[model samples]
Target: MDQQTIINSLPLHLRPFVKQQRYDDYTPRDQAVWRFVMKHLSRQLADSAHPIYKEGLERTGIALDHIPSIDEMNACLARLGWRAVVVDGFIPPAIFMEFQALKVLVIAVDMRSVDQIFYTPAPDILHESAGHAPFIVDIDYAEFLQRFGEIGMKAIASHADLEQYEAIRELSILKGCPQSSRQEIETAEEKLAKLCNTEQAPSEAALLTRLHWWTVEYGLVGDCEDYRIFGAGLLSSLGESQHCMDDTAVRKLPLTVDAVMSPYDITREQPQLFVTKSCKHLSQVLEEFAASMCFYRGGTESLRTAIAAQSVCSACYDSGVQVSGVFTEVLCDAVGNATYLRTTGPTQLAYRDREMLGHGVAHHADGFGSPIGHLKDFSRCLSEYTIDELKAHAIEIGQPTKLEYLSGITVEGTLQEVFRQDHRNLILSFSDCGVTDLHGRVLFAPEWGTYDLAVGSAICSVYGGVADKESLQLFKPTPRTSTLRVDVDPSLMACYSLVDRLRQQPAGLDADDGSIEDALLAALAQYPNEWLLRVEMLAVADSNLQQRLLEELRQLGTANKATEQLVAMALGDFPAPHEDRPASA
Candidate 1:
């Protein structure tokens, strides 16, 4: 099933939190804002953000030009044993933690406008994808996050805190709505400010949330005297990210339970930020906070820390949290999707396999793995096909794809050609056709009709057969104009080709006719502004190819705005900030 259809079919309980990244929802202005942020921050963040932050950006497939696709992100993240899911703005703290506990990164799909680009009052795509998604690439950091989520889920908040969460959610939803007026937004922001500025002390849940904000949201990394931003809040906002680093007025302190327990303001620039020495330090601080929790103090020891010490059977070389460099013998079912109890020394192992009945082994029929910790190969599934099989499954050549317009009119042809106009709108050429549709319901009187060919409506094939909704091809309509001009990124063509190839069968990394990558790279070199497309294709290339592309990008140097941003993003070292770069919004 297509992604949108699959999302629509999901049960109501999960639907709101897990939605599709409707890439088409983004408008031209949104794309412009994304590029603006990428161009500026890619250069501005050179000396400020943690090294892993940029690596995470590359690893997770987040690019500069367009809003990221969560499915594509998950494809890359899956290699690191993680996945990305789209959420509708801010979810409950506990729910957010629950998602992380499952090793799933929750991303907000909405993008901020150019006006609100510098600092979005609530969670948006910039904050989630650009700020948070990249850091998950580091195993230690990923494990630390999962553990934080596990702990945060149990850290119950007070009624007052819940009210604050609801208020924040309402404001975020309002801001994300393109139709929301300035007055309505101001009204919401006013109410949120009052809630944030309240003088009352925060509850345990609120304090824990504060900790999350200081660390995950606005926290810094490195020694107390010298640090860089790893926090999403700092990473996503151009104004704050730069101000926090440049302005000596902002106080920096080591990350600690006490430090985060203090209150903070959301409406204006923060006067202070806490820095952590490393992810391990954050983990230690988290455990310290967990130990002090009212729930833990009430005599219920967290199962997370216990399994590590009491359950070892000795002489094992398996998976799970590593303690004293010993493997914790994690088992799994026929497929690797379900991880069993008592796995590696890795902390994520505990939260990942929390349903064990005894000795970290699940009671289900998957059966407990022997304590011998022998490595099992579950790389390919029983029904999976090889690369050779995938190549054989490619769609037959010379078969022209069919696209249906308004009314009974049909356009049968292949993608005649595709290219970017100055690296902005993706231009696709279809075989010319004489106007038909005498009835004129689909396209008549020069009206505007936008349709997603894949799932929006029924289209017929060359054999006069109705197209299946499961098909991935989408037929988007251009505005009411003489020439067909659609405002989509040109990189989408290569993306469509890659997805089509993958759906047919798993292919090799450098496996296509090379036309798709060739077209993408040609566009990339021609349009320096197409950095996101470069990042997207680079993420798909095999390791060796990615390195080669990096070298090619480096060779370009600080030639232009696009190439400079491309080289900086492709390999985290950007040339000295060009005075010509976009000024902070």
Candidate 2:
């Protein structure tokens, strides 16, 4: 029969049951058993089962007041051109498929006492009717089931080896398995089944079954709005239905074929629900599967992007960079402000002394004899640099100079180890690293500079961005107390470790002392004044223990200062301090 025609012929009231009903004659015990099963499972469904299950109860004319007889259900099915059949217990896959292909629901004649609720192997009347019936009424759902059954039977008949495929797919959909593990099990089963019959491997059909379950059986409705329950498992399970809708952690992601086959835990309520816009959408998915556009392996790009972004971003900010105290100092006789340089090339440009000299020629007299001299003067003229001036400098000098500022800081190796041990006590001090607050607009630096720090502020706004708020709260500087042990969150700490590891790599990407100082200043902007004081104290501790620590901090601060000075000089903020000094003097 044509799919839509079958759908059209279905009785309006019984349409919902078409997907759920199994045909079987009820003996006296069967009726009693149905009543007994319904009575107990009803309690579970009432509180947590999908709303559809309750609707099924009302729509299918199955009364909660008494056990429903098979004859009565068959009459309802017959009205919809469907029927119910009875099986002793477990039926062969082919027979089950045949029943479904004929638009007949198969109900197994078995009973589970109230005590045995926890364990029942085969589908008893309670499970067959109550657990799965309501969804059968939905035309799309019923069609999918019929198709699934037909496909399943064909595969079974074609190949004996496919039984394991059927079993594993059933187990996976009914139960969730991790993807790798599921694949392994499916592979083994397929190989074993193949030994028997290669013509029809159950693996392919089994995958479709899983897809059907994910989309048609346990699928959810709606997007960010109200989600209606539709899947038969959810429709049947009282507790799961309630839990899925109410749980905050139970995210409803857009459904895709991969997500259905993806591992999940069925014993527990799903932590995530696969949501479809409508039943038609699900039907379309099956149609695609029938056409063979959807494959069993390979995932979508969006999924990969989500995984990568989440993995990298999840690491704590503390792990990426450390900040200390801020120091504002004036330079005496520096020749020129340090120029801000940005890398505009497609590939990353390496910044070395020679490169700095080449870029510094137009701005600094006699090229760059000492980058430090330029850096100090740059810090003194911080007020003069404009955004444009900084950008121009960065474009010419390249991004490497930014790394130069961080050079000599022991951010790698032993220093990192020391900081790790006593992160609370160690202060990451900042000097006038060429970064300017710009009224919270941008974090401007000369020689690889000018970033959208305003966006940083917005992200770090206590009221917004998760990353910003979390970083600020965790790293906010505070006075050291005996009980105060500053420990970076594990994720952030990992970032810091990554940075350190990257620095050690041959490329030499370590943040120079100046860049480090600038980064600290940027970080500190998110916190209160007290946090600055705490940072200063920590810096002092490091200064006392390691001479390199202070020098590096000074360099970082100086580099920042130079970048700003260069920008200021370029923008005509003030005369370059050393330009006026006698060349001989």
> How many steric overlaps are in each model, in order?
17, 68
Candidate 1 wrongly placed segments (more than 4 Å): 1-16, 176-183, 186-200, 299-585
Of candidate 1, the 10-residue stretch with the lowest lDDT total is 458-467
Q: What TM-score, over all chains together, does every model reach?
A: 0.51, 0.37
Compare the candidates by lDDT and give the number of the best one. 1
lDDT of 2 by residue, 119-232 (tens): 342355565666556666666767867776655443212123234434533433222222325565566456544554444323444556567567655778776346677666
| lDDT agreement of model 2 with the native | 0.39
Cα displacement (angstroms), candidate 2, residue 570, comes to: 82
Error of 1 at 450 (Å): 62
Q: How much is 522 displaced in model 1, in angstroms?
A: 28
User: How many pairs of residues collide in model 1?
Assistant: 17
